[model samples]
Target: MLGAVGGGALLYLSFPPRTLWWLVFPAFALLGIVLHGRRARAGFGYGFLFGLGFLLPLLAWTGTFVGSLPWVVLSAFEAMFIGAAGAGIAVVSRMPAAPVWAAAVWIAGEALRGRVPFGGLPWGRVGFGQPDGPLLPLAAIGGEPLLSFAAVLAGLAVGDLVRRLVLRQGPRLLVAPALVAVLAMAAGPLAALVPATPNGGEDRTVTIAAVQGNVPRLGLDFNAQRRAVLDNHVRATEQLAADAAAGRVPRPDLVIWPENSSDIDPLRNPDAAAQIDRAARAVGVPVLVGTVLRNPDGRTTSNSSLVWEGGTGVVERNDKRRVQPFGEYMPWREFFRLFSSYVDRAGYFVPGQGAGAVDMAGVRVGIAICWEVAFDDLVADSVAAGAEVLAVPSNNATFGLSEMTYQQLAMSRIRAVEHDRPVIVATTSGVSATITRDGAVTASTRQFTPDVLVDRTELRHTTTLATRWRSAPEWVLVALGVLAVGAGIVTRRRAVRRAGRDEDG
Candidate 1:
């Protein structure tokens, strides 16, 4: 049950405003000491249980959007990697090399989990817990995976301190404590030394307007009035336009609408295009409209954000890099159809691939849409691809006023500081946000509300060390961790041979 408790604790802490909950990871990781050197099966059980405990709650957001099935299914699948991690620990820790081998096995597990099933969930990683902590700069050198490994190292250190103290290995126990202190404290100052790069563009600050075309109703049935939903966004932008014109709100250099604002294709449908044109003409600047585009090669569609410039018309675009498995499109259509009919499979939607950024009137914006914000590579690549400001145009209308919106908003905040770029998050059913490079929210809208957030935060043309060097640290850590495991394997075989010789004698 330690797993369940730890999992619940993780779920509570993973959300916005109070991301401190991630600190539970290192504490939960200490459970390894109790289950230490157990059989592989036992270790797997504990790890799986811990994974279930953490994943069940951490992924409740999936249930909030899709249903309990996805939440349970995804949690179970993700927990498998944790089980494998436990098995690795069981094998590695049995050797004389405890500290090095154990840490490597754990880091390897996290890396594996992050990349499975269409590159992996990677949501509740211990590294994310350090968002507000100084160790966050460590992400520049190593990425989140490295930060996660470091957190594990600290946990291992604490466990080692206890073991050495119990054994009365005075100096060794002191060594463990010293290790913990160093890892925990070094999160500051040194993390700043890692390489970073900013999203490119003019460094000057410009007022940005984020339009939330709030849905009239909330749920699957909500999109019944597709035209009404489209009109709401148009109307909200119209209001912001009026506000800007009168100086009630600062005149924005650009406007943003959330993904899927046009249930009915805007480019093809003259009426829908006309409505967008009117809003752009009113706003007097480029408006990024998230829409479903028709691909000629089949009836399949692409979840795309098109730039609808007032005088220029449709200009630049970015297709969502990562699509939600079941939500955006279904996997193994025939196999799953037997289980549930209401699969609401985004059967028509097509996945779009890009380096993660698109251009807007010489301004490069990184687009982190919906679930993509939770991903490290997506935002990191956007900044690396020369995006100046991060724009997350998401559609959370289906999930309503749960913590999902808030949690996603928090991710935007971390990305701001992680890459030192301003982030613009436009959502269909609220939590529209504008964040600064220092990880502060300049302005935000309430959930399920039709509102506009007006902000003039400095748009960063600079990069943090994290942006310039992405995942380089993770590769290095992985190599070192693997080497430790390999050495442990060799040492264990030698120890077994020595024991056999002693028995023969």
Candidate 2:
């Protein structure tokens, strides 16, 4: 128990702290090896504890933003997947040639974990922590799961070797790295494969700016201060314009503001329209502004974005799809509110229709507003519908200074690679970023600050194989994993039948 706890704590130190993410695998695998020697049920218990230990803190960010009740419930729920992975590992380890089956088991666990409990909170899936690690390149070919597999396999191989060295004792210790080397080389192929991502400070670039108009207050009631928020963005854009003219920074092609930058209902309020016009005209080129729009009926609100065509008020526009579950709108509000305070306070933002992509000069901009980024299908839909460059207008100010912003940034990074497009992420409060096609963060702002980070890059018009295939590779991997397990079950059944016949004879 102490060893497991210590190992789990070590795993906590492995990520965001530095490039030590690889340390987590050996810890998990060693915990597996130690527990595998116990009874099946006991083995599951140990694995679950280790999983709980790891996930409880890793996903603390979830509850950290929402509150303790939410944190406790979410951690317990996320920990179940870790427990499930551990249980799967225990079953696969009982078989002969356990290591190969062990890898398969982990993959199966990842797949299962990603789909359960409201489409599963698929955060911290092992592969994400490898953003700066050598394993990052693997995401292009196999997506996240393959990178996860390699990370786990490397650690498992090390743990398995260490166990053998400690208990069995032999020159066999030397052979483990060679086996892993062959596996890693075959998986990544340093010589033959193209790196999925590119190094920063490259040749081509774009001077794009992200504007953060930090809202004065935090709740939905603060929407009454809509003019103030709009002015904040306008003032920030003016600063950028001055910087550009002074030659401190290159002129930005487009200036992006966060969702809900104009909460005064742009269509209904003429004053709001003029405020946006002022900002776009001040910035010069085009400004993508997130605003609240009401249809002529005025029954509900549309969380929509409009493009400022130079001096013209609103040109191209996009209504946000995938309205947030409890944030933008509520689901089963009366029933859900009994459990928490926030359930009752959610927004009334109505979902919009259409692909939500529009033109800015010649760039095909893919827009996923706030909550929409969490859903991969939305991004895939945007790409299919014709969006060469991606722009995310998110308002993270409500969540305060938390990992939610970083997590959202990570999600945007994956979308960039998944679709082979340059992603410009603009957030209110902080962490606005410019992502290249390769999933690199070229520039970003400090949290809760009014600052602009600028980057220039080639806007890729081409789509990636991942975008064309979408989630097909993951489906293929899952199918193959199922077949492998099914084949093992059949082989075991045949052996049992043969033994029964000999006994009868």
Candidate 3:
């Protein structure tokens, strides 16, 4: 149990805003040691303990605004997936090449965790922690699933080797584990050698700007000053225009605003519409204005990203496809309301359809509004739909000064590498950044600051293997895990029958 707790702590240390990504291997190695020969029930209990140790702290930021109740509840729910994964690992531990099977089981657990209850909260995915690690290159090859597989395989191999050494096993016994570890670690650098199509190797460059206008204050009430938030963005863009005119900065081809930058529906409200138009005309470029659109029924709303052209009001628009649960809209509203009054505070936002991409000035830009970035399908759909550059328009003010922004920033970085496209992140309160295809942050803003980041971004039309295959890798891994579990069950049953026959003899 102590070892399991240590393993979870180590895993937590691997995540942002920390760079100890190598710690994940050792963490999982400890977990493997604890669960190797344990019964399924015991494995679950130990794994749950490990999960609590890890998730409670890693997700502490979640309670920054909404209080500790939601945070604890969310952590407890997510930890159950890890507990189930531990049980699966135990079931497959007796199989030949157990490390490989165990690793596949972990991926299977992630697959389930990423899509259950409320479309699965994929925030703590191991792959997201590897943006700065050796396994990062795997994201381009097979996206997050493959990256996670590599991490788990390497970790389990390490655990196997360590266990063998401690037991004074022969060198012959160590060969397979050593080879697996070497291969898993090598896969990352080898995958990195795959030539990335940089900006599609074309001379076309689009100078784009991401505006972080910030809000009046932090917390849930940040949106209370809705008009002020909109004005802040307009003021920032206007400043950028002044800078461009004075030859201080290059004029951008397109400008992007953070999500909820205009909580007041610009299309319906003339005041909001005029403000956006003024900013667009001043910048002399189409502004991707993030706004809330109230439905005719007034019972629901759409979080939309609209392109406000200088002469043409609103042109192209991509509504946010993955509306966040609880934050955007409450699930089991009536049932949950009994537990906390915050349930009613949830928005009436609904998920939007389409590929989450929009065309502006002949440039195809992908949109993953804030929470959408956490989902694999959302980003892949945008890239597959012909997105050359990706934009993550987010509003992180509600979380206050927490690691949520940095953690989310890491996701964008991984996505940049996964799709081999430049990623522009525009946030309402801070950490707005421009990430290149290699997952490097080129420019970023301080938290709670009003700033505009202008960069010459290349448009890449080429797609990586991840974008091409999409969820195929994850599904394949999941299938392998199911087969391993089935084999384990069959093997156990065969042993039982053999024992019964021996008793009869």
Best by lDDT: 3
Better of 1 and 3 by TM-score: 3
Name the weakest run of 10 consecutive residues (lDDT summed) in model 3: 195-204
Looking at model 2, residue 212 earns an lDDT score of: 79
In order of TM-score, best first, we have 3, 1, 2
List the candidate 3 regions with Cα displacement exceeding 4 Å: 196-203, 500-505
| Tens digit of per-residue lDDT, candidate 1, span 380-493 | 888778877889999887776666677677667667766777889999988888887666676788888888888885765776666667666666666776776576557667
Q: Model 3 over residues 159-246: C-alpha lDDT tens digits?
A: 9899989999999999999999999999999999986554344547899999999999989899999999999999999999999999
How does model 1 fare in lDDT?
Answer: 0.73
Q: Assess the local accuracy of residue 145 in candidate 3 as a C-alpha lDDT between 0 and 100.
A: 93
lDDT of every model, 2 decimals: 0.73, 0.70, 0.91
**Candidate 3, after superposition: displacement of residue 127 in Å?**
0.3
Best by TM-score: 3
TM-scores of the models, in the order given: 0.90, 0.84, 0.97
Of the pair 1 and 2, which is ahead by lDDT?
Answer: 1
